[model samples]
Target: MNASLESTMRVKSSTEKDFLKLSGVNAVDVGYKYVDGKRTDEICIRVHVTKKKKTVYKKEMIPAEIDGIKTDVLEGTYVPQMLSPKAIDELLSDTVKYRPLKGGISIGPDRSVGGNIFTGTLGCMVTDVATGKPLMLSNYHVMCIDNGWHVGDQMNQPSLIDMGTHADGAGTLLRAVLSSHVDGAVASINSGINSSAAIVDIGNVAGTATALLGDAVRKRGRTTLLTYGFVDGLNGTVNIDYGDGIGVKTLTSQILIRPDTTINPRFSNSGDSGSTIVNGDDKVIGLLFAGSSSAPFLTIANPIGFVETELAVFIEAGLQPNLSKGGLENE
Candidate 1:
């Protein structure tokens, strides 16, 4: 780490807890400061607030600078990136069922709430470390839903919420990791179902890489399809609402992404959770899990290295798309 990052990390380590206790503050991290919507060269501590207020109590007021380092307050409400029932219906017609499952498509557990099934995107394909079998990767909230969901629960493509029925079964939940650093899970693909290492429009992942500030990134997701962004922050901690059973949780050491204005204004949206974030070289970098739907549209993802270590699975990549069993054809 450089001097600026090191200094910011030290300040964050010493003051993060106090900042989190303040009302309206939801996350804290180190990143380049922005002025008038343009990023500056200076590194500062970023504070993500659910909403910004014109006036606040003295106790809630965030300082302009702390420990000689600047601070920034961003407004956004972070939640687990899953589609609501109404949103699922609107997107139903477009959710295609891929024969040989690949990365970056609709998928979810067989569970439901108020008769509407849950839905999220599949992140990628991986090899089970213990069994060496092909398994589909996605968020724990998408595959397992809650702590009550057991191993072997069924998963579906296009998700059951997106007009996919039980007949569209694609895999079974094999493992999940809802840790401080990762919100990932893997499912065992059904025997007849084929899977490819290729992401929907991004082609095959070359390998895994570490994301650095200002690095260009891209992802294909269930809701947004293909979009580009930039790594704007790192080693961050954010609070996310994972619904009733899981409730509010804090995730640490996350990779933060901001929209790439040249391509699309928005990055990941709801139902885009579990999308794999890749660097410009097509190397996987992070597993997208949460984000704000509003301005700046900051997306939060778990570093792929942390996810792999937490879930004990290796993301399979670098091979050409397989052509057997009516699976994906390489472009």
Candidate 2:
């Protein structure tokens, strides 16, 4: 971590709880702040208050500096809204078939009924470290029915959202790890189903790369198609709203992507969750999961290295040929 970021995080960790205890503070993080028209890194605290509530807390309740690091207090109404799936699978004709399965396509859990009605993106193809079998990767919320799924559940391509009814079954949930820093899961691709390790728009991912501040990256998702951005934050923490009763889950050590304003105003949007983030060389960097809804939208992702270690799988490179035992050839 850079000196500025390290100092900012130290302040965040030491004072986050104190900030949150205040009536209007909803979230806290480390980000850039404009000081004298120059961008300076600092600890950012989000204070959400209605026009009426703002009067209750005195200015002293929010500090302008903590531990000598500049503190930014952003005042806005912070409503905790639930996050819904963004991928809206285009309905295809019953006769229309997806010839080759690849990353950046629709997929979802196979329930007894209405399995294909909802869908998420297929992140990429990877090899299971234990079984050496080629498996498809995606968010647990996308493939596991948002934590209600079980092992051996059927998964389908072109998901139900794309009209992939029971007849279009494609794979089975192999393993899942949703209760951690990442919302990830994998499924075993079924026999005779063709799949490619390459991502859409972006070509084959040669390998994995460590995320660095200011690195250029891009991803192809089911919703927004292909978009590019730059890594703006590291070792970051975020709170994600999983709905009313589910509340929020705190994710740590996350990579934050800000849209390249010079190119596009946005990076990823709804339904783009589970897309793989890769660098200019097409090397994997992170797995995209969430984004901010407001302007200067930011995309959040789990570092690819962390995801691989947590899931015990290796993202496959190039095209993967069908193996009788369902294993990738090079592995």
Candidate 3:
């Protein structure tokens, strides 16, 4: 290995465990060192931060360099734990059962706690590159229960949150990746179920687009459905609370969403966790996952490119129909 790579590996192996245990620090990773905005072959430490002020001032904190490798710090707000609940009457209604299984619809793991329902949005439909199988896309927390799940676990549309019970199994969890960089998962769609590439209220997706700062975007979510927003920041690092026992997890390389306040102040809510972010032209940009608890709530998402690469799937465009399903159109 190169000297810098060797040094980075050694430093991370020696200090990663201790750094993660520190308060206000959210996550840690290894990457190429950058100087004056230019990439370098040197290895470096990248730290995710929630409470920047507190972390920078902590006594006996990790130094700027360890074993001659530089360190970089990224700061972002922490997300709070909250649930979005639907009306009990709606959950009992038959309309939800009849709704098409498509992007931006409700979905969740087939598990419950003391009768409480958990639900999130289905981001989109992607095809496995290796097998060419259709799969449902969503956040790891939304579909895999933040790593508290197993392959073959049933996935329900309308989620238990919307009253989808075990009897209403919609799909099966195929894979999941819950790391500091992403929170994404996929599931095999049940046979005979109609899955679409169209978003609930946003119509058909054109294609995948890169997220640029200040770009206009929109999303159709289970809660706060069909909201518009702008890409406020990129490569953000934030601390996200995944509830009790799971505690807080740090996310890096995140895309930030700020709602179009002049129109509607909220970009997303709890149940909107798995909604896909799209540009005005309906091109995929990112996968929605978490947001702040208070006003001017900022939304966080994983970049679309990262998600596609990590999941080994492609978020199909509306024009491309599933050839295997008799030309079934994508929603």
Candidate 4:
């Protein structure tokens, strides 16, 4: 992340040279412009900055005010990468650095999304399955409002909670890698990411397998990074309520670990929607999403197969090519 780039926007001269001078900025461009009766307080600036560089893939982002909100975007062929929990935390702490950065990855607003920087508890991964293209994924509702691409002046990424910063005391910092733009349809699928993802075994249970009651498991969340718990139940369901009169009810659950009131192993509160939930063996068993408060409550996670299936469909459709070549060739 180099240094945190703060500020969602700044009034800059319409020249590329002027925008580059903004703190945390890498570059700038204009996506569109409109002055309406409702846009009295809006700010607009098209800026670009380098986010990732792999021998196979390199990318940049531009800042634009979407509906009066200052934000970065991935247009045409760009991808969104992720920052590790430590990196994100450090940047968030340095308001000056974060504000001037001039760009950020967009999380989606699928029903599965809990929250983001506004509420913190979100660190994400967006990846291409074919050649293993990379991205930092999150609930988009926080990144863009209804995916309309609104432009405006703001303090930070929409709805991002920064749970690490808001935490009361010492807490674990999660790690995540950001790097690419995911297919817009990834969130539209009911089954979650499809089989396009490599079935890497980090712990137990193995891809989509249900865990026995009391099995120890851990998961890596974009916001909280990694946390552990025990499988509490099977074939369970929870009715989770969210803002906008939206929520997931009778939502399926593959794990029900013993409540961790003492140490809060679950990674997200409300904002870490869609994070991966794995067993002790490191096999992602479910998607760690809606919880009571980014920490407690009987968390509801979607089946791993669901996510894989969605990703697979996007891959087969040739949405985004995995520039990394599935790690077959190192940069």
Best by TM-score: 1
- Candidate 3 is scored at a TM of 0.72
Instruction: Evaluate all candidate structures by whole-model CA lDDT and list the values in order.
Output: 0.86, 0.68, 0.72, 0.33
Better candidate number, 2 or 3, judged by TM-score: 2
- Candidates 1 and 4: which is better by lDDT? 1
Q: What ordering of candidates by TM-score runs from best to worst?
A: 1, 2, 3, 4
Better of 3 and 4 by TM-score: 3
> On residues 34-95, what C-alpha lDDT tens digit does candidate 1 reach at each position?
89888899899989898889988988888999989999888888878878686754554338
Candidate 3 all-Cα RMSD: 7.5
**Candidate 2: stretches off by over 4 Å:** 22-26, 34-56, 59-62, 73-97, 112-116, 316-331
Steric overlap count per candidate: 0, 4, 4, 99
- TM-score of each model, paired residue for residue: 0.95, 0.81, 0.72, 0.39
Worst 10 residues of 4 by lDDT: 94-103
Error (Å) of candidate 3 at residue 35 is 29
Ordered list by lDDT, greatest first:
1, 3, 2, 4
For candidate 1, the per-residue lDDT at 242 reads: 85
| Runs in model 4 lying further than 4 Å from the true structure | 1-132, 139-209, 222-225, 245-250, 260-268, 293-296, 311-331
What's the CA RMSD for each of the models? 1.9, 5.0, 7.5, 22.6
- Candidate 2 scores a C-alpha RMSD against the true structure in Å of 5.0
